[model samples]
Target: MSSKRRVASGAVLAALAVAQGVLAAPGAAAEPDTAEAAPARIHEIQGTTRLSPLEGDRVRVDAVVTATRTFGSSRGFWIQDPRPDDDPRTSEGLFVFTGRTTPALTQGDVVTVEGTVAEYYPGDPATTAAQSTTELVKAHWTVTARGARVPEALALGPGTVPDALTASPGGSIEHAPLRPDEYALDFWEAHEGELVSVIDARLVSRSTDYNELYVTTKPQQNPSARGGTVYLGYDRPNTGILKIESLIPFSQRPFPKADTGDTLTGVTSGPVEYDSYGGYTLMASVLGEVKGNGLEREVTRAQLRGELAVATYNVENLSAVDGEEKFAALAEGVVSNLASPDILTLEEIQDDNGPKGAGDGVTSADETLRRFTEAIEAAGGPRYEWRQIDPQDGADGGQPGGNIRMGFLFNPERVRFVDREGVDATTPVAVERDRRGARLSVSPGRIDPQHPAWEDSRKPLVGEFVFKGRTVFVVANHFASKGGDQPVHGRFQPPARTSEQQRVQQATVVRDFVDDLLAVDRRANVVVAGDLNDFPFSPTLRELTRGGTLRSLMDTLPESERYSYVYEGNSQVLDHVLVSRGPRRVSYDVVHINAEFADQASDHDPQIVRFVPR
Candidate 1:
């Protein structure tokens, strides 16, 4: 007889009938010989959130099957005790791994399982350092009954969830369950691997590449004016957010494209587990209806009278390979959305051949810029002129192949480039003053090109332009990226910001140069803009504006409205426009085009500011 038939008779058969909660077979009321023979509760096998105390020990548990995954590397079913334990820290649910074999059981069916408890790590156990999940391995089970009751899912949200996942100074998870009610990491640690639900939660960020959505039950702290959350400071905590992972098992394409402020109703049920990539996530088995509203494309603001408009945009490594479609969309955004600004500071402009040619050490970007300018004109914009200095091969760090650099695009009809002698990739420009005011010695030159801070980074491109008979000195920068910095959700507590030191040095060099320009002419019309790759409150920004010679235009807007980039769920400011004392009462705005949408043309939203030169 098969294992299924052998377990479906005598005492096992009677117990299976009684587990149904409806009918009682003969001799179903008979008790076991001793209390030790009775099955253990599910919570006992899952003592704490981190690890089970009874791992590797043989035990028997009686639980109702809640969910099952029949195909996959980790094929398994979740079983939960109908009657939960008194301690909230202990989870009443446990996963039973059956490998390739399908267990002879159905949802809501009561069964008695005998197995050895083990802690399983998803990835390689040797290298990756993360918490392990408790499971019942090499298990055999007999159906105790059918139609058993399933435990109600515990609702998780604010007040019930903690504020932040890691402690400050050192980003690490607390293991002692201290302040479990106040910290999200602690709160989630207490309820690991338990059946959970999030009802009527609103999406806080767009769906990720892995088809995950971040949602919150209450309004997120430090909410941006454009309907996203902001990272206040290093000390401030961000709590009350949950990651919804893998919406339903075996369902093709579970996640739907959603924007911030969209509502998700219905009882979204799942098992809470620690995901290596996403921190604590609810591997959901069921998702409710997604209501998408309150999201629309933002319109361009009208240009101010007598004020020259200057814009900064990171095109996300645009090259000739981006093809005509992307270039057209980008042109539409520049012409229609940016109102054909007089001067445009651009970053991430690739070499002429894009990534492919960049690998062969080709440095000319003339073809790339020409194609983009043509596209802009075709989209009904001004015939613009461009200027830039190609970096030494492999000196500027970015994607290994794509040699990215900073450049400028100005409407020649609106502004004139003030050219001077002796400007090249290696030569540094200096601030000079005539009877009129401060001007660049070299119209299109680099600032401190040989500075150690710019060793492997894109050198700052300084250009001198005259708008309506007034000279405006513009500095285009693409500072060191935060490539090596540890993720805020990673294992390290207060993840290390390794790239900050280099950015600080870069900012200092630029700040000193700006000071020199101001000293020559305190009222110099200087507009410094591009992807600074740092936050407004970061030490890097403070170093740049230490003497108050330059002020961030973002500071002029409401704190909630100052953002140009979004990562995870935090809307942050990586690009900025800082003006010297000359440009007064500048009107600045972060145009809502990209960063918030999945189909966005670029990863960053362009920023536009208009000011009348003094």
Candidate 2:
């Protein structure tokens, strides 16, 4: 057997990794008679079962336990199946299914799971990998009750009550505690294409900034349906500011008949459980039951203020284009939603060349820039004025024609733009290439040689806005890319080529710039705003607040009202307005507007802050 195969086999019998070492709390483990013990040592099994299985066929099995995931009522993990050294199918692996009975098994929990050998034909790796490919390329084995079964352990936060041991179903079952996050990560990847069930799952009340869901394996299903904290979302048509009521969990739920630990089983999909702003939770399954409870009202726009605030939103791929109509509509929407706010910072608005940046048939990058100026002027209350980076054709780590840019618009009647400077910190290519001993190039598009100096340039648009006889230094910037395949998502490219390191370097450059600005102007009432590509706790952002150079506006606000963007159901605070060292002359706040306003238009929300210049 190859070295890799041997390693794979070793993983099957290896002990599970510790999760903060929290063992079964006070008699939480299952009884000795009910538990199944793993074989002292398991046998090795490998090869693709391209053909149908021989009736009653039994095969010895040993493979590395890649991960254990939970969705609905099922718990499962993946194992790399060994194949011939030269076989194109060598990359194949198998998923071992388990029942969802909490003190539920966790990620990296290596148990000897055995079942009848099954065969499944190969299909699109992406599709079949999640389906039943294992049935065709069968390697069936059922684990015996010889492996040590850790006694059932009670959970700390939300306790559980083990139900009566119903008929042991057909197959034997066993379990152990596992790390929640690791379990969620592995489960989503392994069963990403299958069906699953969940029970007694409660909806997490808070909004995930990015609209993503996060669950805590078994933890999310404990106690009763109402006690389990799970984030919820749905697949629907039409985008922009999806209402919280549209999500399934908020509108409906099941009763509390079955407790959290009761075993529920179903086909599994991905993202068994995960962590987020609220906590962790488990995904639901096909056969899962929700105790019928009337609808619950969790989030409502009535919770928002009617005026005087910045509303941050993602203008999905707001590219530099010819028609300023789209920009005009967006400006119109902002004006309608906010109705007030002396200043507004926008992220992802394309403005490649100052206000004249152009692309393809587009005349300039600031098409929206122009539209915004016009729209505000048309609105008539407070005339608008704007400023943006000069897209000097990629002069300073700037995009071609300054395609997608970040800038702000001020209500001239309310405030005035005093002076400003850009914060460009992209390290030069020569410096990076010299450090790595090789030339660096990204697949999406290489840095332009003609615009050499552009690589190290990224400046936060720091504008001095005068309001009520006080000056507020507003630093607006958009951070590095998220690097995914979807254009609606942050920029995506290969790791080495479109490396995060480059983005990190860019962040460091900005941090230094902010620090210097603070040093020179001690009394400056600085407020940093814009879409920072990274999350709040991300290391780069941590540095910005390390020495108290900046204070997060969200930190001073209530939780429910903090988020500025929603991704996949998860509400996150990506767009921010940070304050600097000085008296609080101006207060920062997210307008807390309805997300439906931005679902289809853009991927970001606009953020506004009110300042009474000191």
Q: Pick the TM-score winner.
A: 1
Model 1 lDDT-worst window of ten: 1-10
**Global lDDT of each candidate:** 0.76, 0.39
lDDT of 2 by residue, 463-489 (tens): 555566654556566665554312111
Tell me the tens digit of each residue's lDDT in model 1 across 1-614. Answer: 00000112243334434542243221111121222233567778777545677877777776677766655566667787655655666677788877766555667767776677888876665544455678887776666576655666777765667565655535344244433555566566656666788988877777766677777755757777656777667766456567887635536645677777677778788777776665678777778667886676565675666787889999998987788988888898899888888899999999887778645878878888999999999999999999998887778888767789998999898889888978877889998878887888887999998999998899999999888888889999999999777666554567778899999999999999999999988888899999999999899899988989799888787877877887766778899999998996688888978877767778898998889987
Q: TM-scores for all candidates?
A: 0.85, 0.49
Off by over 4 Å in 2: 1-195, 199-314, 319-329, 351-363, 375-381, 394-402, 419-458, 484-500, 558-562, 583-586, 594-600
| Native-to-model Cα distance after best TM-score fit, residue 341 in candidate 2, in Å | 1.8
- Locate the minimum summed-lDDT window of 10 residues in model 2: 237-246
